[model samples]
Target: MCETNHNHNIKLDKNGNCNTDEHKTWNRRSFLQALGLVGGGSMMLANTPLSVSRPSPLSIALSQSTNENILVLVRLQGGNDGFNTIIPVYDYDVYANARPLIRIPPSEFINLSDDYAMPKPMNKLESVWGEGQMKVVHGVGYENSSLSHFKGSDIYANTNLQEDDRTGFMGRYFGEIYPDYFFNPPPSPPSLQIGSIGNLIFKGPESDYSFAVSDPRRLLQIIENETFYNLDGVDENCTYGEKLRFLREATNTTFDYAEVISAAYERSPEYTDSSYQDDSLGRQFRIISRLIRGGLGTKVYLVTLGGFDTHNNQIQRHQQLLTSFSEAVSTFYKDLAADQSEDWAGRVLTMTMSEFGRRFRENGSLGTDHGTAAPTMFFGPALNGSGFVGEHPDLNNLTRGGNVTNTVDFRQVYATVMKDWLCVDEGLVGRSLLDTDGGPFESLDLGFNCSGTTSNIPSDGESLSHIPTYSDSQTFINIVTPQTTHIDVSLYNIVGQKVATLANEMLMEGVNMVINVKDSANTRLSTGPYVYQIKTNNGDYSKSIIIS
Candidate 1:
């Protein structure tokens, strides 16, 4: 287990002492000197072939090993239909036949040769896939749930279908592993929620760990201004006043750190184009690239691209939105490779998710209604690589509205990421955030035996009854199942709310489906213990992802 250093401080000096006036002066001069040094001609020269290898002097010294574990979550809000983004060229004949209006012809796909290909707009990712660094997770979803944008999104975001899970899965891990020092909280002018008010993936109770900075370059400046310093204004004691004060201070520190990061990005010779649609999603990815290259100490980052609520106009909108996502993500990947930060190279992992997938059958509008069981993708360094995880539900065994049944529990993916990729000990993960033993994994073939050995198979429902022998925070259900899928599973945290609707819409039998959930980035769901429930065709089942 990684030892927690509760005394860690962000103070300027290594001696664990206060900065001297002379030292402060030195830093100020250093900051101004660095600013003055940026010459236009020098920038052009740096951009030339001569400056390719020399990274910015401002880049922070980071341990390549730990840094490589960075997690980049790209939330495709409004239910991104994975079918269109990652078209099955080998099966395109079937997919195109399913939704002629929305299908990307086999001719248009960038083939991987093994029956699958990326949509044309995602040509950039295709190139990355060839490099043996990318992995694709198909047909990911939980059992017994269909496309209901609101509930589906919440499920994925919360991981535990509990309504009272105040802290998110990632947030809980961060809090337990890197407990915040109250003295040095986040500086904030509070960045805008570009796609929305942040996803549940980043929320926690300790220090404010994540910031949805719409434009870090601009927002950083506002946070650092002296007026906002310490954030306390004249009306310091008032509730609103105190709130403003906190935001000011957080904003200041964030920008100060961002300045150093921005400089590194500016120095890099590799430049990612602002091409690809020029939309908010495109811009967000562009900025993420900037921050990463800039050497920001950000470990968990969030970005989203919406418009997948394809209740209508599924063809045009879904296509365009996905193109933007693919293009931007691909470009970001290419730029990272060119930076030659191999340590940082594979360190970044990007995953895509949505509320819930549309129905397996098409609606009369030449579109699809809110159905469950859609495909999701997890392509990044930490993934097992190539191929998929989890099982693809049989489309024939769907619910009333033709929602494909699911086989995988979305929390398994989160558990894998929290324990396997990020290296957080299961104990530190906090059961309050993820109660894996419960929910969809209980019935799936994930291979989890709870017998000490880590297996990928889901456990028997009875096994979920045991309060884990280990810490609730870090224990993960070891399910043994294929990683790829046709219909996907996702998890969400529902605060203390009990299972209100456990009734299955009464569908065809055989295979059971799972739930898909998503949530806000900041703030706790609600203060109380919670339960995660998975509603499937057979019945509704739930366990605790988190018990807080």
Candidate 2:
């Protein structure tokens, strides 16, 4: 008999084993809701709304900028059993003894080298490896890893091992590149997130940098329909009717980026190749491929594949998941390669990440529990060659908790990718990764090296800073200039109309200027949301404020 435990959100049998078959019956809406995609941000895309942070004029300007390389983050939602995924050919005896029931037959796995092999279910990756487009980083994790899935995922995304930090490494990088993010967002999304709804990887200090959607079908509908929100049916007789109309109109105008997204989708050729699977992950990759081919200049994308939490029926369940993942990734690369003119395959990199690895030994239930460290896989022609980067953890040596000790710090891989593949400056990379105090982590040699790349970040002595503060029923724009330069500060409404000129004069060097918005406007202001923009010779910055 099977019993549901609402507290733990799982189903268990009389023997206390997890009901693995339940995963097979999950519908799209239930799966997405489980992933926490129900709320926050704006509602734009179809029934399943797309979460989006309102972009500023500066954001619009930055979106027009372009970068050569792109990154695709494949989030393996649950903890993957690494020992099963990457068989230890060198230590086969020890591995077999550890998981005798779940041990893969020697002949069943595809051999990569004398030291390691991949399960047969992932045979599709053999071609990717043979083409010199795939590489694996062994035992990639942080020290003192958290076994809890929620905490582990947060630690990996934020790159902070000590405590729960809301900001992510990518978010920090985006924040640094676009300091005035709250005021001026980029033209296109800085990143596009397709699953992993609640993941903090793209969360900036004040707002999330990515435009997120729960599923590809809704995103497709958005592109096809080319409409954000309909305000026609709103009843004027309803309570707060004027406010309701104003809110809807404001929301409709804010989603103008939907038109931009639709234009890009329309420009790309229709995806007619049926070789790609018609399942969840495959459909996601198909949409991503279209966006990339259609000239959507988003730099980073994150897609997810769950069901890695195989605590029961390990053999059948794991095989199915791996098979799907391998096939989807294989077809995604082929789809990109179809565009011969752009060399899209050579410019894009795909990386896989999980919260953690599973226990080194299989449990009585025939599955492994949450443990530590796993292999991180990278795929793309840009990798230049195929091979393993770190020494595999010794099977005989285990921690007190029976988990594999990490041989490579995951942050090292992130630092290397940010510095080399993304062409970010070494100094900014250190700051973004929060390793500035201890100095930047050592970057690994992952085949390619950045050359002739110059950073656009301004020096500390040349940068300007602004802070908006509310005190005693008055609004203040506190400006700290690095050196005296002409400054112009203005306020605008939700509809992009200038409402007040807060400041339009020159300030002295090393001076701190604070302007009172209410006194400076020279008119009575209503209570609502407003954007205050500061224009200086150094650069432009803006942020939103709520007047209540």
- Count of clashes, each model: 102, 7
- In candidate 1, stretches whose alpha carbon ends up further than 4 angstroms from where it belongs are 1-67, 88-101, 113-115, 181-183, 186-195, 206-270, 274-277, 381-385, 430-432, 436-548
lDDT of each: 0.48, 0.73
* Model 1 steric clash total: 102
lDDT of candidate 1 over 1-548, digit per residue (tens) = 11112332123335534332222112211232244321111111111110000111111111011323566777777776666666656545556666777677767768766666777777767756766556655567776663567677767866666454545665554443322212232221111122445345545564333332444334445534523354322242222232233344444544553444446546555455545347777666666566566565455666777677787878777767766877777777766666675445566777767777777656778777776655656565444345545555554465666666665556666666655555443543336346755432222222221223342212233221212122433333222122212221222222122333322243332323332211211223221122333333222223333322
TM-score of candidate 1 on Cα atoms, chains taken together: 0.59
- Worst ten-residue run, lDDT, model 2? 23-32
lDDT of 2 at 175: 69
Q: What's the CA error at residue 153 for candidate 2, in Å?
A: 2.4
Model 2: per-residue Cα lDDT at residue 386? 94
Clashing pairs in 2: 56-185, 59-184, 59-185, 59-186, 59-187, 63-187, 183-542
Q: How far is candidate 2 from the true structure (C-alpha RMSD, Å)?
A: 12.5
Residue 495 lDDT (model 2): 51
